[model samples]
Target: MTTNLPLPQFYSQILSTLQPIFDDTLPLSDPSTQSTLTSALDNLYLIQRMINSLGVFSENESIDEVGEKEIVFMSLNWVIGAAEEKGGLGGRDDRLSALQRAETAYTSYLEILNSYGVLSPEEQAESSAAASGQSSTPKDPAKKREAKIRQYKREKELRENIANSLPNQPESSSSPITFLLCLLPSTSNRPSVISASTGSTSVNQEDPDEVSKSTAILILRLLHTITIASLSSISMEMELLSNAPASIVPLSDRDPREVRREEEDNTWKLDRQPSKYKPRELISGNGRVLRPFTILPSTSDMSDRERLKSGVFKQSWRLPTMTIDEYLEEEQRRGNIITGGGQASYDAPTESELLELAAENDGSALAEEKAEQKRLKDENWARFADENKKGAGNTMNKG
Candidate 1:
C-alpha cells in the first residue's frame, strides 16, 4: 500500500518539475529533457491519484484529471518532436502548435475546477447540511417553482437590458481628399475623375497632403468661418504658405490695363482690339435710324499682352446690330435732324394733253393715242391732193 502525500507537497513537486521546463533558457528542444519532464508530470499525476484514493485529497478532484494530464503531456511531446523535425524552435509553426496545446490544457483544467465542488469551509458545511435530513426542511412546491420562474425571467431581462445599453455608432467623417474635390472649379471639359491605378471612379485618391494644404488655404480665405486658433492648428499640420507680403498688390487691386498687360507677356499672341471697319447708319421713312454695331471690351484700355496671359481675352465680346429706333436715339443725342429734301418725288400732268390722252385711251392707252393722231394727219393730206388732181386734169385737156 502506497503512503499518500499531502496536496501541498504534491503540488510543489509538480511545480518544481514544470518550472525548469517552462524556463526560457531551458533546452526543451532536446528529446532527453522533454522525456524527463514528461516522466516527472506522470509521477505527479500518480501521486495525485494515490492521495485521492486515500481520501487525503479534496473530494472535488475531477475524475478526468488523469486523462487530461496524459493528453497535455503527449501533446507537448508531439510538439517537441515536430519542432525538431522542422529545424528546431525557431520555426513558428512548431512553437504555435505548442502554445495551442498548452492553452487547451490550461483551459480544460480551469473548466474542471469550475465545475467541481472546490468550496471553502463554510460552503462545505452548507453543502453537507443540505445533504443531511437533519437540515432538510420542506417548502411549498408551488412557491419553489414560482421562484425558479422569476429567476429565469430576471436573467432574461438582464441579458436584454445589457444588449439595449450598447450604442449605435455612426460612419466616420468624409476624407479630406473628398472634401477638396468639392472645391475644384466646375468645368464641362474635365474628364470623369478616376484613379488609374485602382480603376476606381472615386476622386478621393487625389493626394491627401495636397488636399489638406489646399483646404487650409481655402479656409484662410474665409477668415470669418473659423477661429484663429483653429486656423493656426490647420496651418501647423498642413504647413501652408504664408500670405504674400503687403508689398505685392493682389491681381484684383491692379488696373484692368495692367492686368491685361501682365497676361499677354508670352511670345505667341494675337491682337486684342476690334476691327477698324465701321458699319454705315441708314435713316428710314419713319424717322428711325439703323446702325451697324459692335460690343466694346469691358476694359477697353487693357493691352493685348495682359488680356492673353490672364485668359481674360479668350471669349470675344458679342456685337448686336442696333434697331432703327435705337439708332435714332443715338442720332438725336448728337443733335442731328431730317431735311425737307429727304421726301420722295411726285409730279402733275398738263390739262389739254390729259383730256386728249384720256379720250384716246384704250386698254392699250398710250398706243391708242399715237394711232389717233396719225389717222387725222392722213385725212387732211388726202383732201388737199384731190383738189390739186382736178385742176391738173382740166389744164391737160386744154393743151
Candidate 2:
C-alpha cells in the first residue's frame, strides 16, 4: 500500500513562498523576509524528496528521459540562490554546508545533461580542452593563480562531499509524508510551514536541446561565482584556525586539565638531551635567525610615553643639512635662478640709445629752437640758485 506524494499542494506552496525573492520592492530587513524564505526552502526540500521518491533519477538516467527534469533543474537553481541569501536551508547545517549541497545538486544535474547529450559539439570540445589544460583559462600568471585556487576549492568540496542524501529506489509500502520525514534527516528540526494556498507554476516538459544545454552552462557558472567567494572565506577561516592559539574558550571556562596542559606547553623541553651546552644565536633582530626578538626601546620611549604606532606613516620635516642660502646657491648652480642684470650689463650700446644720440646730433630747426630754450633754461637756473643761496632762506636746518 503506497501513499501518493502531495506534490501538487507542495508545488503550490513553493510558488507562493518563493514570490518574495522575485519581488523588487521587498526589503531584506523586513521582519517577514527570513521567515518567508525559510518556509520556501522547506517546500523546495519537500519537492526534492518528492522527485526522489519516484525513483526516476539515477547514474544511467538521462535528463531527456526524465519527466521532472525542468523542475529538478530550477530547483537546483533556487536552492543555490537561497543558499546565497540565508547560508543554508532545511537540513543544511551552515552556509558552507548549504553551498556544498547546492554544488552537489547542480553537478548531479549537469551529469544528467551530459548523459542526455545536450551539449553542443563546440561546447563539448571546449570543455574537453579545458580539462586537458589546452586553454579554458588565460596564460596570465594572475589568472593561473586564480584557476589553481578555484581548482583547490573544487577538489576540496568534492573530497568532503555530502550528496542530496536521498533514497536509491521508490518504496511502495512507505507513505511520502513518512518518507519525507525519513528522507529529510531533520524535518522536525527544520523550519515549519508558515502558510500554503492554491497556486500554480508552469512546468516545461520539452526534450533536452541546445537552449537547455546553454542554460545548464549558465547555472554552472552561477554556482561557480557563489561558491568561490564562500569557499575562499572558509579557507581563510581554516587558516585562522590553524594560526590561532589552541584555546577557543576563555581561561576561566577551560578545563583544569587543559589549562594545566597549556601551561606545561609553554615550558621548553628538548627532544634530545644535549651532552653539552652550546652558545647559539637562537634569536636575533637580523634575518640570520629564524626566530627574531623584539628590540626594546631605550629609557626615552618610557619618558616620552608617545605610544607611537608602527606602520602608520606620519609626514615630518627632516633636519636641515644646509641653510636657505646654501639651498638657493645649489639651485642657482642648477640654472633655477638668475641674479644681477641678465643682458643689461653688456658694454655695447642698445638700438634705442643709438637712435637718441643721432636725434641730438641732427641739425634741424627744432634742434636750434631746443638749444635756445636750453640756454635760457640754464640762465634761469643760475639766477634762481644765486637768489636762493644756501643760507638765504630761513630754513629750519639753516647753518
Candidate 3:
C-alpha cells in the first residue's frame, strides 16, 4: 500500500507565512498578522520534523529532506543574525521589530536543527571514539601539502593562460594637447575676435563652413606638431645610445621634414602625369628666370551699364593663378609629386582663340531662314487638306 505525503502543503504553508513577514506595509492590527505569525511558528515545527525524516544523520532523516531543511535553516539563521547584530530589531512598539525578533528566535532554532542534521554517522562515530579515548590515525600531512601545491600550480597556470589569450594593446598616444584638441569646438560663432588688442573690424569673421574648415586645419596642424615632437624625442634618445644600429641613429636624427619624406616614399609610389599636352617654360620680365603667368580680373572700376554692353561680366570665368614653383611645392607637400618637374603643360585659352571658336560655330541667320521656309510649307499643306475634305463631303451628300 502507498501512503500519501503532506510535503507540498507543508512547503506552501512555509512560503505563505514568510511572505507577510517580508511585507513592510502590513499593519500589526491587521487580522492577517495573527494568521501569519501562527503559520510561521507551525512551519518552523514542521521543518524540524522534515529534517528528522531526512536520514542525513544516521538514518534519522532522508538525504533529500535533510538537505532542503539544512539550506533553509542556514539561510534564515544568516538573515536573523545580521539583523540582530545590526540592532535593527530592538523596539517593542514597532510591529516590524516584534516580527523580526520572532523570526530571529525561529532562525536560532532552525540553526540548531541544521547543525544536528549535518552530523554524519561517521563523524558521530569519530566523536564517540575520541570521547572514549580511542586514538584514530590522522590523515597524512605530506600528501595534503602536495595536493595544495598542485592546486596552486593549476590555478596559476590557468590564470596565465587566460592572460596570454588576450590581445596585445598598442601604446596609447594620449596627451594634454590631444585631449584639448578633441574637446575644441568644431565650429564657432562668426566675427570672432583674433585678440583683445585687435579692433572688432580686424577680427576674422567666418561663416559656418569656413569655421569648420579652419577648425579642421587647426586639428591637422596640432597632429603634425605632435608627430614631429615625438620623432625628435626618439632621435634624442637614439643619440644617447652607444650600440644603436647605424641606420636607426642616422635616420632617427634627421630633420622632421626629411624623416616625413622618407616615410612617404616608403608608403607611396608616384604615378607619372598623362602626356597629351606639350609643356612650356614660363618666362619672366628679366627673360632669364622662368616665371608663371598670372591672370588678373579686368579693372573693377567700370559701371554696371558699361560691363553689360561689353559682355565682359556675362562671359567672364575665374581661374586660380599661382606661380608654377608654388604649385609644384604644394603638390610635393601633399605627396602628389616626387620630382621637381619643370612646369605644367596646360594654360588658359586666350581671348582671341575663344572668339575664333565662337565665330566658327555661328549659324544664326541661316537657321532663321530655314525655320521660315518650314513654317510656310506647313501652312500651305493645311489649307489644301481642308479644301479636299470639303469637296469629298459635298460629293458624298449629292450621291
Kindly give the number of clashing pairs for every candidate.
Answer: 7, 0, 6
- Which model is ahead, 1 or 2, in terms of TM-score? 2
- Candidate 3, residues 243-282, lDDT tens digits: the string is 4323243565679898887777534222233433222333
TM-score of each: 0.19, 0.34, 0.19
Against the reference, the lDDT scores of all candidates come to: 0.38, 0.43, 0.38
Model 3 local distance difference test score: 0.38
TM-score of 1: 0.19
Q: Which of the predicted structures, 2 or 3, would earn the higher lDDT when compared with the native?
A: 2
- Residue lDDT tens for model 1, 1-399: 232644433433343444344433367778766676666545655654554466542336543343321222212222222222222243444334444443333333323223343333433342343323122112688875774465355434433332222121101122212222223322232223333334455322222222232232322122111111222232332232233222346688889998787667433233334544334334444656443354334434668886576456444643344445555566776567563442342244444455566656567766577667656656777888976874576855674
Candidate 1 residue pairs that clash: 260-306, 260-307, 261-306, 263-306, 263-309, 264-305, 264-309
Question: What TM value does model 2 have?
Answer: 0.34
The predictions' CA RMSDs to the true structure, in order, are: 37.4, 22.4, 36.4
Name the TM-score of candidate 3: 0.19
**Superposed Cα deviation of residue 120, candidate 1 (Å):** 15
Q: Candidate 1 vs candidate 2: which has greater lDDT?
A: 2
